[model samples]
Target: MPHGDPPVLGLVAGQGQFPALVAAGAKAQGWGVAAVGFAENTTSGLAAETDWFQWLKLGQLGKLVAFFRTHGVRQVVFAGAINKPRALDIRPDFRAARLLWNLRSKSDNTLLTAVAGELRREGMEVVSALRFVPELQTPAGQLTKRGLSRREQQDLEYGWPIAKAIGRMDIGQCVVVREQMVVAVEGLEGTNAMLKRAGDLGGRGGMAIKIFKPGQEEAIDQPSVGLSTVETMLEAGLTSLVVEAHTSLFFDRDASVALANRHGLCLYGRSDGQDGGD
Candidate 1:
């Protein structure tokens, strides 16, 4: 539908700023993006960022497929986090119902994998959000003005393995630690909520570690953080955040760094495998 010459991108949007970031990035690359928004989740402002936009129910598999096909979309990327509880209201079409019934496991991995396979079958390649947003990749070293103190580094060293172990169990990719003790383990609540919970439990500030799953599927789900994460940490009185360098995505890095520095938060990006273990 776009007049100019541009590669078509299908954006499966969810909640928060993640979808908007991805749309903006793709559009910046001269891609005509068709963003599909959820009813109560995605911000309608995302429409202006994309070449085409439509709101579809979570279970509208047929509509999603049709939107991509009509828009000549060859590349698809899912962005943002969907509130799983709200998805309970989904009225899956026959296609989605069949796919759901066929899958024995219903984790995010399984669901996304099935959807990816279906898209691939339709000649649409489901790509990672990192494809165009290269700057989002977490860089190694101290990102904020305040570098990780020896004590916090010790806690990060201890928490990395624990966080990865939890990720391996398909639980979550984040854990908050203080003095080598886990103050919180992220579950269904997500990173921001987990950070607040950790701050409440730990009192004052603590270190937050986010890591990728041991054998995570590259194209589907890669762990990511952005400015909002730093904001959450500040709200929770957290002074340190550790992310798996290279493996995780850190969007809006400059703004995140500026915010972190303003709040005295130490943001460390390190390699999980290289962090010498206990």
Candidate 2:
């Protein structure tokens, strides 16, 4: 490697625009991004944003590591998320399969930690994606013109800790509640599906709360919300949304708040300190 060349930052990219955002942010910080995108999940535009890029299938762990090492990447960040279905259907190589076989639980925290451990064993540092894109961290307080109404506030209070409980169990991060009763808790079907299902069971109005898991590995994963979340809420007829602030990655705040305002929905960023309800 040339002595004057920029440091290489490897990216393990998944679905959505997050990989691109991380790449742009890393470049802005003078790091050269060598990103690998999962063909099963990442957006097509990601390749153009990277210094070196490869489209690889999910669970090709050895190939993933070899690609980064070959390109001289010493640090890596896992950005975005795999589609739940695609991730569940992964066909791991012998190396990856061994890593999985050693895990006692298939829970997210355990699995991602093992993956990061494998990278570390190969001399690559696994750093948080937030290190490059700190501005994407969701801010605390109400983000929309409409604040949570009395009923909706009660619902959030009712559901926030419950969401964390599910997350702790690696069951899910998001929960839907109405009138202090649990309407739905997200499973492998994911948030959007859970939102729609909540509407089916609870009718027009409920509060949705998504929290960071108690033991989640911040370096590799975090809850992501965006304009699409607001759109899904509008479609599902959920009236209020709250996410653990400073822990989740939020995107398109302006558009999300505008849409939420138009639909008389509430978007609030919360932390345990806000109400001691994590």
Candidate 3:
């Protein structure tokens, strides 16, 4: 873990370009990267970014740990979101079967926490993906071409607390609101699904508000929005996106913002209780 000799980091990747970004960030910081990609869910291109790569079926926890140990990986980071519904198709190995049986609840947080505990028991540390890439965190302020109007600011004020409360309950991080009414709340289906639902319910542009739970752990499950989120908004006919600043990761920031601008979307980064200045 020295300046020049970075720790060997293990990446557990699923779908999307997130894994590649993490690999790029780790390389920039001089870390040797080893990755385990899910057979059906992960992008194969991730193997190219890593020093060593292994493919595993979902629930092959033992194999994943063994691969990391063999490669001298001391720290592991999870990048990319797993498709929860598809995870049902996972074929658990003996170790994974035991781990799954031990879970009190099958929610993502419970499963991940249990896995982290298992990793620690194996003498490996689980680190945040942002450890080497803090720049991915969204800054506080208006982030797109159009600033929030008074009405939209009020909508954000009304929705922010609800979104955070939902997040605290582990329901989800994004909520769509309009005119002080909750249009849609994100659950297992994810942000894009929630956006489409809100658009259907609201009949036009809805305000999207995302926030972290009051005491949410930053190491995992930090609120994330990206170009996909912007595209979802455009398709859903949403007007604005407001997320908790400093705690949120705005993936592919420039392109995301450019897409927002092209779609005339308002993007604001603010504290849970604060309003964007006009």
Candidate 4:
């Protein structure tokens, strides 16, 4: 309606700090934010942080598009995590049911890709959340003051490809490695549960490796580690963590690094074509 209004960015908010982070970044850039927060999955704090906010159930795809269109948002970013198990309880609207019925598999990637495609068809572009917050991207090399020991380095080398392979199969992005043996692979229960299992089986000094899934859309479901991750690792007696640099997201970097350093845990970011740190 206004001749010189700032562009509005729509945010499909899920769980965690990611939606809030994206909204803050967009606002800092002098852009308006319209956030559609998921019921139960999204934090209530996001409503006050955004220019406009609406709460929608998980599979209300039709309402999601209508909210963006009504807010004059032509571009949107999908941010944060939707608890996968809880999503099963969703009462999808007709639009979402159609999309679900046509899917060959109910994998995360397939569902998200279909949603992105639907948004595109509805005159909206689904952009990367990182477009607003590039700092969340993992930096290459050792992040903690403590470098990886030889045994840990070996475990990383052993686990990196294994994690990637598992990701490729859409199984999970995280795996626990100890003494060159695979301890636990993340599944529906997620990284925290897997780490707890690894601690029980392998005890302390295991390495947690997380990587992006091959052939998956980076904008939607990139692997991420944050303060909670470090806390879980500490509780699980895991001593080291490795993530794909540039591809994975590292949220709350300062706090996470400080916690890892305090526990003498090694936090390393392995870039493509780079050797594991010693």
Candidate 5:
């Protein structure tokens, strides 16, 4: 570390506001943020927020690495979500192909751990963005003005373990439950689609439970909820949300809470061994 030379961070940007928020947090801490953004999947506004920016296709692992190294980034954070279906269209280069080949399973955890390992081998450490933006981590307790009703609490209690089990299997982060019956489990279609499907199948008053996958590398790919999530839940007639406390990101927390409060939706962050409610 030298005077006037801040720590440089490489951001692997994906969709939504998460990457931008990370960039802001890094800058606020006097760090230089260089980003490699995915084409089409990443937010366009992120380019202006970073010290350096490069756009690349999903499978351009070599390019992503070179870009960060060239910009003097020794640490990186993977932020935001990549639409999994679109990822199938990626044309992996030699590096990515070899990495993929070495994997025993292509589940999210295995793949990301491999990528992180690759980055580590390249002298770049993969760190959690929460290190720079601790505020984004969801705190334990009710997040909205209104508390969960008895039925909503029941639904959360019923769905929590199921969601964790699905996460442990690397299946998904969310499950929609109503009246203690599973309405939908989030798959490659993502949380929003799962909520929509739940609305169609079970109608209103369903609870969506999202949790960090067991044994996941927490530095990347943590479950996240944002304003868009609240909007989607409202549209899908969902009445409550349960996210794993401290292991999930809650972007735009105030705005999300306001919107959920307005819509009379309950948002709770529950940790292991704790009951969810007001």
Candidate 6:
């Protein structure tokens, strides 16, 4: 209620570095971050990083709304992902249940978009979490000393649209292909699980292709990868990764690249139909 107070932005944080990245970016830009973290789904250390922090269960829509209203937050950004397997256990309150009742689809895009709409109705604008952290966007070109080989390039190009199409259907964000045959598709279990299956089905030297879905909620929910992705790919015996550049998130890039290099794997950033890597 005081004049000269910095604008407070509400952060609906989920898991991983996404929330922290947004919080740091917000503070760096001179904005106050009032964050709510999901129990067991968020890092407890995030409490120390926020101006105001609350731990809430996944379906506490009423509490979430009241908290932001109490803090006079007019803008909100959703970052990170709810552990979908764990999300099966959420007990939606009456408010969140009411919102969930009318949904025809419970896909990630559908649910998040609906939640954003609810926030908008409550006078809180849900903006892209990357608004302040534009640098988190993936870089273009070969990210490791090992660039794409001819076969790897074939797989990347072959799988890009398949991955994007899966995303477009709001199914998931990853597809595994080798020698132009799709071996795995990401489903409810998520990427790492899918990679494990690809290893069995595609054998060694497959490529994993990930991309931002066409018509996805831009910069809100995105395709992303990091060191864990490379580690999973290594475990899966996949030799190359091609993720959409400047559109998707690439967390822990240096660590991922170093790991990929150690294994002589290719880490290529791409945009659909736009090949900028060697």
Error of 4 at 268 (Å): 0.5
- How many backbone clashes can be found in candidate 6? 0
Candidates' C-alpha lDDT: 0.84, 0.88, 0.85, 0.90, 0.90, 0.87
Candidate 5 lDDT, 96-167, residue by residue in tens: 999998888887788888889999998999999899889999999988888889888888888889988999
Which segments of candidate 2 are over 4 A away from where they belong?
276-278
Candidate closer to the true structure by lDDT (higher is better), 3 or 4 = 4
lDDT of 3 at 31: 85
lDDT of 6 by residue, 1-278 (tens): 47999999999998898898899999999999999999888999998989999889889999999999989898998888889989888799999999999899887888888888888999988887668888778988888998888877777777887887888999989899999899999988888889989999889999888888888777468788998999999999999988888888888888899989999999888867786355
* lDDT pick, better of 1 and 6: 6
Off by over 4 Å in 4: none
TM-score of each: 0.91, 0.95, 0.92, 0.96, 0.95, 0.95
- lDDT tens digits, residue span 1-278, model 2: 58989999999998888999999999999999999988768998899999999988877899999999988999999998878777888889989999999999877778888989999999999998889999889999888888878788778777787888899998988999999999999988888889999988888898889889888887877888899988988888899899889989898888888889988998889986476222
- Please provide, for model 4 over 1-278, each residue's C-alpha lDDT reduced to its tens digit, 9 standing for 90 to 100: 37789889989998899999999999999889999988788999999999999999888999989988888887889898888899878788999999999999888888899999998998888888888999999999999999999898888878888988998888888999999999999988878888889999999889999998988887788899999899999999999999899988899999999998888999999985567963
Scored by Cα lDDT, where does model 6 land?
A: 0.87
When summed lDDT is taken over every stretch of 10 residues in candidate 1, the lowest stretch is: 269-278
Instruction: Return the candidate ranking by TM-score, descending.
Output: 4, 2, 5, 6, 3, 1
Can you give the lDDT of residue 258 in candidate 1? 91
**Which candidate, 3 or 5, would have the higher lDDT against the true structure?**
5
The candidate with the higher TM-score, 1 or 4, is 4
Cα deviation at 35, candidate 4, in Å, is 0.9
Provide backbone clash counts, one per model: 0, 0, 0, 0, 0, 0
- Runs of candidate 3 exceeding 4 Å displacement: 1-6, 276-278
